[model samples]
Target chain A: MKTRIPVAVAFLSGFLMIVAFFGSGEWLSMLTNEALRYMTIVAGFSLLLGVVSITQVSWGVVRKRGEDWPYKIILLIALAAMTGFGVLQGITGGTVFEWLFDKIQKPMMATMFSVLAFYIASAAYRAFRARTVEASILLVTAIIVMIGRVPMGQYIYEDLPSVANWIMMFPNVAVQRGIIIGAALGAASMSLRIILGIERTYMGRG
Target chain B: MANQGNKGFFTRLQNVDRRVLFVLIFASVIVPLFFPLKLPVPVTPETREFFEAVEAIPDSSIVMLPFDFWPSTLAETEPMAVVGLRHLFRKNCYVVGLSNVGMGGPSIADRLLDSIGGEFGKTYGIDYVNLGYKANYQAVMLGMGERIEDIFPTDHRGTPLSEIPLMRRVPNYDSVSFIFVVSDNVAVDYWVGLVNSRFGVPMGAGVTAVMAPKSLSFVQANQLVGLMGGMKGCAEYENLLGYPARATRGMDSQSIIHLLIVLFIVMGNVGYFAAKRKAKVEG
Candidate 1:
C-alpha cells in the first residue's frame, strides 16, 4: 500500500506536468507552476536535512573521539557560529557573518581551489604520453589549443589562435552536441519510464 | 648493456618526484607575476560576440543577470561578471540580478552591484534590483516568462517589486533584452533551455574554463548568442571595453602556467621516448 500510494502520486504529478507543457489550459499551467513552487520549497527544506545529517555525523565523531574529532569539533563550532551570525544579523548584515565568510570561508575555499593548478600540472606531465597514434594526435591538439588560447600563442605564430578556434568550433562542438543529444534522449526515456511507473528504483525498491 | 647508463637518466626523469613539479608550477605562476610578460592580448571571436551582444542592447533596456557560481570559481568567472556588470552600467542598462544556485549568490551579486553601481551613481530599486537567490532557477526562469512579480514578489532588500521603479516597468522577459548567466556549472543551460529556447529570449554565458568547451556547442547551435570562457575570455571582454582590469593583469601568470604545462608535457614525452629506445636496443 505504501509503494502503491507513492507510485500513484508520482504518476499523477508527472503526467500533469507533461500535460501542462503541451496543454494551454490556465488551470493546468497554474497547477504546474504551483507544483514547481512546491518543489522549490522542498528543495529549500532539503538543506535542513543536510544540516541534520552533518550535525549527526559530526556529533557522533566527537562523542566517539574518532580519528579527527578535533577537526569535527571545529567544524561544528564554525557551522554553529556562522549559522548563528547569519540568523542574528542577516547575511548582508555585514559584521560577523561577512567577516567569517570573507576571512575564513572564502580564503579556505580559494586555497583548496588553488591546489587544483598544481595537481593538474603534475597530472598532465605524468599522464600525457603520446605512445600511440590516437594519443599522439590528442597530445598535439592539446598542445596547440593550450598555446593558441594564451597570449604567448599569438607570439609563436599568427595563425595559431585561428587554428585553435577552428578546432573548438568544429570538431569539439560536434562531439559535445552528440553527447548532449544522447543524454537528452536517455533522460527523456527515463522520465517516461518513471511517469509510466516502469522505473521503480527511485521508490527504494526494484 | 652499453646504453643502460643513458636509460637511467630517462627513467629517473619519468619517475621524478611530483613535489619538484609542484614547485616548478608554483614558481611558473608566481615568478611571471613579479616580472610581467605584458604580452599583447588578442580578442577571440567568442568574447567579441559577447561584447557586441552587450553593446547592441539599447540604453535603458533591462538585462536579466544571474550569479550562478560558487566562491571556488570566483577567480575565473567573477571577473567576467564584474566586467559585464560594468559594461551594462556604463551602457545605461537596467540590471536585474537573481540566483537559484544558493544564498551566497545574492550576496556576491550585491557586492558587485554595490561596488560598480556606486561608480555610475545608479540608485537601487530604480536603476537595478536584485531579486535575490530563489529556490528553483528553472521554475523562476520559466515563471518569470509569464509573470515575474508572481515569482518574486519582492526584491532582495524586501522591497515590493511594484515599489521598485525598474521592476514596475520591466515585469517579464518581454521587457528583458538579454539573459546573462555567469556560472561554473551548466546553469546557463537552464537559462538557454527554459527561457531562451522556450520563450525566445536571447541569452549568453560566462563560464569557468573547465566548462567552456561544452558551452561552445551552445554558441555553435545558436542557442547562446555569445560566451565568455574563463579568464582569457574575461580579459578579451576587458580589452574590448577599453577598461583593462584584473582579468588583463592575471593573464601574464596564466600564460606562464600554460607554457610550463606544455614544457612538462614535452619533457615527459622526451623521457618516455628515450626509455622506449633503450628498451628496444636491449631487446
Candidate 2:
C-alpha cells in the first residue's frame, strides 16, 4: 500500500507538471503552482526530521560514551544554543546568533577553505608527474593553464591567455555538453521509472 | 661521493616536506598582500559579456540576485556579489535578493545588501527586497515562475512580501528583468534548466573556479548570458567597473600562488625523471 500510494502520487504530480508545461489553462497553472508549493513545504519539514535524527544519534553516542563522545556533546550544545537563540532573538545582525556566526563560524569556515591552497600545492608537487605521453600532455596543459590564469602569464608570454581561453572554450565546452546530455538522458529515464512504479527503492525496505 | 649526494637531493625533491610547500604558499600569499604587486588584470570575454549584460538592463528595472553561496566560499564569491550589487545599484536597478541555500545564504545576502545598499543610499523595501532562503530550491524556483510570493511569503526578517514596496511590483519571473546567481554549488544548474530555460529570463552566474569549467558550457550554449568563474573573474569585473576593490587587491597574491604551484610541479617532474634515469643507469 505504501509503495502503491507513493507511486500513484508521483505519477499524478509528474504528469500534471508535464501537462501544465505544454498547456495554457489557468487551472492547470494553479495546479502546478500548488504542487510546487506543497513540495517546498514538505522539503522544509524535512529539516525538522534531520534535526531530530541528528539529536538522537548524537545523544546515543554521548550516553554510551563512545569514541568522540566529547565532540558529540559539543555538537549538541552548539545545536541547542543556536536554535534557542534563533527562535528567541532571531538571526538578525547584532543578535547572539549573528555574533556567533560572524565571529566564530565565518572565520572557521573561511580558514578551512583557505587551507585548500596549501593542500593543492602539496598535491601538485607530489603527484603531478609525467610517466606517459598522455600524462606529459596533461602536465603541460595544467602548467600552461595555471600560468595563463594569472597576470604573470601575460608578462611571460602575451599569447598565453588566448591559448588558455581557446582550450577552455572549445575542448572544455564540447566535453561538458557531452556529459550534460548523457546525464539528462539518464535522469529522464530514472524519472520515468519512478513515475511508472518500477523504482520502489525510495520507499525503503518492505 | 658528489654523484651519490646528487641522487639523494633528487630523491628528496620527489618527496619534499609538505610543510615546506605550505610555508612557501603562505609566504607567497602574505607577501603579495603587503607589498601590493598591483598586476594588470585583463578582462576575459566572459567577464566582459557579464558586464555588458548588466549594462544592458534598463535603468530601474527589477533584477533578481540569488546568493546561493556559503561563507566558506566568501573569499571568491563575496567579491562577485559586491561588485554585482554595486553595478546594479549604480544603474538604478531594483534588486530582489534570494537564496536556494538555507544555511548561510540568506544571512550573507542580508549583510551584503545592507552594507552595499547603504553605500548607495538605497532604501530597503522600496528600492530593494530580500526574499530570503527557501527550501527545495527546485520547487521554489519553479513556483516562483507562477508567483514569487507563493514560494517566499516573507522576507528573511519575517516581513510579509506584501509589505515590501519593491515586492509589490515584482510578482514573478515575468516581472524580473534579469537574474544574477552567485553560487558555489550546482544550484546554478537548476537556475539555468528550470528558471531561465522555462521562463525565458536572461541569467548570469558567478561560480567558484572548480565549477567554472562546467558552467562555461552553459555560457557557450547561450543558456547563461554571462559567467564569472572565480576570484580572477571577480577582479576583472572590478577592473571593468573602474572600482578596483578586494578582488583586484587579491589578484597579486593569486598570481604569486599560481606561479609557485607551477614551479613546484616542474621541480617535482624534474626530480622524477632524474630519479628514473639514475635507477636505469645503476641497474
Which residue pairs does candidate 1 place in steric collision?
none
lDDT of 2 by residue, B84-172 (tens): 99999999999999988887788899999999999999999999888888789989988999999998899998999998888999889
For model 1, the superposed segments whose C-alpha errors exceed 4 Å read: B1-7
lDDT of 1 by residue, A1-206 (tens): 97888888889878976776667777876787777777667767878888989999999999999989999999999989989998887777366987788787877887899999988888999999998999999999999999999999998899999999999899888989899899989988998988888999998888
- Tens digit of per-residue lDDT, candidate 1, span B1-283: 3555555888866766789888888897778778888887898888899889889999878998899988877888789888988999999998999877674677788888888888899998888778887776777777787678878888877788998888989867898899888988778878877788877988889999888899999998888888899999999999999998888888998988898889888989999999899999999
List the DockQ of the predictions in order.
Answer: 0.68, 0.83
Candidate 1 residue A97 C-alpha distance from true site, Å: 1.7
- Candidate 2: stretches off by over 4 Å: B1-7
Q: What local lDDT does model 1 show for residue B236? A: 91
Worst 10 residues of 1 chain B by lDDT: B1-10
Which numbered prediction scores highest in DockQ against the true structure? 2
Top candidate on TM-score is 2
